[model samples]
Target: MTSALSLDGVFLVPPEHHVPDTDRAAATQLLGCDDRTLDTLVRRGLTVRDDRFDGRDLFNLALHSGTGRTVPEQAFAFSLRWMRGTAESLLAPRTLSFTLTAACRCADVVLALPRPDRYGGAVIPAPEADVVAGTTVSATIRTEGRAVPLRSPVLRGLVEEFAALGVRWVKLPDALREDESLVTTHRVATCESASRWLARRCREAGYAARTRIGWVVGMLDLVHAWVEVTDDDGETKVVDLIFAGFAAGVPGANPLLTDPAVALRTNRLVPTGFEVGARVARHDCDAPVTVRIKPVKE
Candidate 1:
């Protein structure tokens, strides 16, 4: 009764393993098959041979049967529904860490790195450890984090709408009062707080949106947070609502969709890293993932 199944290039290992009743019920409906018929359809769906696109094709057919729309459109709608229903749950506890190797910009014999914080922003340090100009140094820090899956059209629209509302930077409060929520405060917000607030709004408005904790280097060399939304086309975009103002390519254009790298470069922040999705560890997790920065050679 065990069989392997693939979804969006990810495999459900031990395919015969039991799926929770709730999940099974959801999948049954999503696949547009009654409980009794799902087994046969799943078996048939998974039995395809070497065709690389079979999984997607099969999924599309199933969704199309249920939605009466093209697979992508249906997927878009389905992801939106999923996001709305599961938005808050995505903030479940997770671990995140960052390791940076950078050459000292000055001859102070020390390296200054922006440490990662739980809320996704950090203060620039005077300098830490021993190092010299053109010398490579490495440092790592670990902390608790929450991750949200931001892949859905409705979710993306929610982020865009929030970004269009304008963004401002707020200093972290001395202490967050009990019962005070980051959302609806709206005075000023850091990248992390802003993203979380946006996630909250998405939940309120019926979309699943997630606050992302990761590093953004290049023009803007800093550990930052942002919003992530996956669209129906299976593409994900990072929405830095805090920097929404910089996205003014055309007058009044929504900048949430602007590329972080491009936005940082335009702001003269000079991002050294453009990718997100750092390894998320559990509480106090300290597994070292190597990252090295080298000085330019003459």
Candidate 2:
């Protein structure tokens, strides 16, 4: 079933709309490096257009410049500032579209395609999926959507309430060490683990919450997991603990949980069923699947 929401009139800010910029002097100051070092970064592939440097380029250089060394706090702050700024810009109401395709060699296949839904101040209108079934199966799915400022009071209240749970965000390698049997069994959790934990907690609290597996679209799309919580009024909201923790630099702050201005820029959320791409099988026979995603020009 497709969602009833529509994104026809929303205005979306593309990634190019808010590329952070800085002069040479400001760039040096932000990186805490000398001109020569900055030049070295340029030689290493950092683009400097019209004497202005891109914040993302500078952040990457600073993050990986020194071998076996921790990134300086100043440089980290510079990255966070740019990230926050870009995220804020992406929160503006906007429309977007993408073409998604999946192919597999199998007699029977079920492709879990991108479905229309509302979250992060965005609404994805339902689109038709073209499916061809045979010895080889192929499906083409198109999605067009719009995002507006998230200002729901119930969502905001849920954010504040979840914050009271005090769950610490931990990335992998470290997160693997924590207990996953229960949310309270460990203080730190990764996105998937945390989402599952939060879903259970929300259900216990009399709220309808479910863990969702999908992709977080950005400069690079990555498999991600999050939660969807529905209020008594039947309104649903997204709860992404990992993104919230990273954006706010504090688990308690959780701006991504509700603050539209702090939304991820150059990045959007795409939820799917069970897994991304396609799942093809016939009488215990499984087929390998290939999936591709590209922006559709309107």
Candidate 3:
């Protein structure tokens, strides 16, 4: 049996670290605030004392339309940033500094489950949300490992093969907690499930890879995730395995951005990773707004 390769360094930033700069104008609209209120706040300024505008606020006020109560921090952070920019821009056009720090470090939960050969086996385990106390032996979740670099040739190859699966998404009820559950319970592939399956396939194939939990642009509520591969050419690229089949007409696009609207919106990519204490800086003073990832804190 091949030894299971651990995917280290593939850390995910905690939800608190995902504070996104938001559009103040759009956020006002989504929060159902009136124009006069926005004008008042802009003229007077965002009060630091108000709990609604506190630093810990992670609500995605830009979600002009969504059913959930807890908004994405990225949306809320971006909104606050926009407000600051607008207020300062009126006085003078100066470079604004934006910094993102992970709220708390995160430890990965690695699970060892029954590996199904390509022919037949459970691709992933069900009850992914269930917590095990002491007696559980079917699977083992480990928490220690280094982050895997996505620029390995082996990983790139896995991306190609997984995309070749040509898995079609099976739309299940929103009632389902995780899209990956669909794969274990129903054998269908959604963006979430497909990415999970791809990560698994990469592991089974003996390449170091891991799954990430985040969203594609413009579809934050739907909550999209994908795989990051280290290529032989020293490039780390995000592979949307399922979306590759759906959008690229094949699965090997360099960035593999899935949403058409987001693809049309920008030429720059928002920096992605799961590093705690890593800094995400957005430079909008230039021609195109670009995000830069800084070294993770020790």
Candidate 4:
């Protein structure tokens, strides 16, 4: 029964027959499941309306139930659904409110707050925080980002170039030797390595680029790294090969590679800078600092 479903969890219903509510038989057929499996899915929290089902709900159920595919395969599928808008719930929120807290045991810490102008988001009453030893500092920030159309003409060429580079980078074999310098190696599998590689490539091609460590607000909010490229016209844009590579299932093709606006839609950037204050003892500030982020529900 599971074999009937797509590995990436996308099941497209023909437009002519698309409807909010589908009959039991049609729902089972669309989900590539038998009647018994459909019933089991409903019991597992799949919503049904008057003996009918929504395609999206079915898709989510299949996705969460584990498609028996590898992690990379699942990530690619989720990326496709996100780009294709089949998974609206997974899309980036227009307005997001979050709380950031940092704690250290030894020395005073300085942390950078998100700036509205820098992030291309609106943050009213800007975020502020003060960190002192043995105390936890916290701040709440609300940010908003406008959506950009994926088919914009101005970014078509740039987006295509980024997509091509991303595909090539992902296909490279893992490096056997561990080299710290970005110039000495090409093997990159993680976000940091990939961003560094892309930044070097961009600079070699005559574009100003740098690797940045920051937070990526998405379906899962976490700290991440990506590249920033500045064009000749003084416009800076984000070229996140790792994020775009998630949807680059086909060689030389990734529809998600567009303007920072489109990239921001799924992976919004929140740049973070850290400064360590005076230390009381030689190992007073040796303890690792921790950061916790929580999304505020409105």
Candidate 5:
């Protein structure tokens, strides 16, 4: 390529405009508002900018369309977090936050499940965790490894949380609930967006890869995304995790009971073994956006 200065005749360069030192321009500039996209949304009247999604184009979209500002509520908390100390010690002095989830049509019971635990399984489970409860929901539901109490406030809270999310769930004390009736359920999330993010991370890690687009479209088909780690000897270990879009359905379950899994998934979104394209969308954030996966080699 040759420079304009070297051209035989005077070459014309496209005119460039610089930002002015005006206060309005300075403030709006920080918002990254462009005259083209943002001006369009606000002109239409859709959404208002609150303290969410951070002054991004999505805000402008809502502003123009006159759309109601949608915010994610503090959904629910987990019961397991209450199991912090020994079961005997954990009985009293406990508080849970929640909204009623499901309506149990069969029985006259009103259930309130626990709030979802953000840090539950995402980070490493406590080192002393399984040493006490043997790493199962059934074990932790009991006090001192015995089901003598039959029921606790924890179980009651568990019942209520599920009622909030429109799921008919029951608080099954480990000792009282029927084992065969309570089948172990497996749930999965199909996060198309996260798949793209992971593909980017894989490329960043020096692996030439692209997301399996067909597989992502079949998130219902592909079912899950697992973390695969390899040691120096090249023996690979894969850990299954809770990511975005997980837990759509399961047997004999309600939303409140299920969302705790999502809470664990949410708290684990950052720094807990990650790559790019690691999230899937819960709601369509407008049309799907894709970045460069890998540059084409010549």
Candidate 6:
């Protein structure tokens, strides 16, 4: 007969209810388990007092287990759940929506938000540097960006995968690509920048990517800043990031000057006029010629 509940790796729904029977059978097949496993789970107290574990949780856990490390996507999802609220409230619906948001956007980000805030470098507005000549132009654009250093592990893995694939990018797409941020269509936030090139690399590897664009502080009076992506179109685009300024302060001293060697490492926009006041590479620098103005690739 059907088991009362499933847990300890084998729980679906109550046997008496035929309505959930079809679902039970499917779960049993996917979980690769039988009634005996359910009994054992009940004895071990992993069972539900009222009934079986929620079907969705079972599916997510199984999918998570199966992923192993082929992707850190599962782990990232789980962490988002914990970051929302108390452990019990984790199951609450509104919180779940927050957890399942398609992607992070400049607007969706909340400043001084609680745990699970992975938006790039989190600069808490240094009181001293706060007043760097405010202007009418929107600094709001920069505020939404999560500061990410080029050294995070997840980004490193993606870059390596891209290099291995040997991507050959052609031209930018005629239409604006979809965004992972909201439910509706969106153009690439940083589309005009290097995102087009980065997306090509990831696509070649059978992975997905997006580019977040903006102008670098003190760099160009106006230029796009973008970070590469590999998350499945709608998950968090920027993970494991650092404040652009702190990244520059490390022992290497002036990180912006040294170009990244890898095909996929993320980096901050170079400061304004560092190389442009005059030619500044000291002979081992990897950056190509720094043009006075960014060139239009035709």
The predicted structure with the larger TM-score, 1 or 4, is: 4
Candidate 6's displacement at residue 166, Å, is 14
Candidate scoring better on lDDT of 5 and 6: 6
Off by over 4 Å in 4: 1-93, 124-137, 144-186, 218-221, 249-254, 257-267, 273-298
**Clash count, predicted structure 4:** 0
Query: How do the predictions measure up, each by TM-score?
Result: 0.33, 0.46, 0.32, 0.49, 0.18, 0.24
Ranking by TM-score: 4, 2, 1, 3, 6, 5
lDDT tens per residue, model 5, 229-259:
3223333322222221123322223233233
Error of 2 at 203 (Å): 1.3
Model 2 regions more than 4 Å off: 1-110, 117-179, 250-267, 273-294
lDDT of 1 by residue, 47-143 (tens): 3333122333344334324244434335435422322223233222223222444322333332224333323433233234222233343333322
* Model 3 error, position 50 (Å): 48
Tell me the lDDT of model 1 at 114. Answer: 34
Q: What clash count goes with each model?
A: 23, 4, 24, 0, 50, 16
- Kindly provide the TM-score of model 6 when superposed on the true structure, using C-alpha atoms: 0.24
Model 1 lDDT on a 0 to 1 scale: 0.38
lDDT of 3 by residue, 175-246 (tens): 332345445444446565676676677667665556554323223223345665444554444566554443
Residue-wise C-alpha lDDT for candidate 2, range 1-298, written one tens digit per residue: 0121111221111235324477998878656667887787566556677778666445444433332232433434443443444334434333444334334444454444554342433324343442333443222333222333434454445555555655544333322422345345544455677777667767777777787765543413445677676755565656666666555552233244335332222235555644211232222343344333444344
TM-score of 1: 0.33
Prediction 3 global C-alpha lDDT = 0.35
RMSD of 5: 23.7
Model 6 segments more than 4 A misplaced: 1-194, 232-235, 239-251, 254-298
Candidate that would win on TM-score: 4
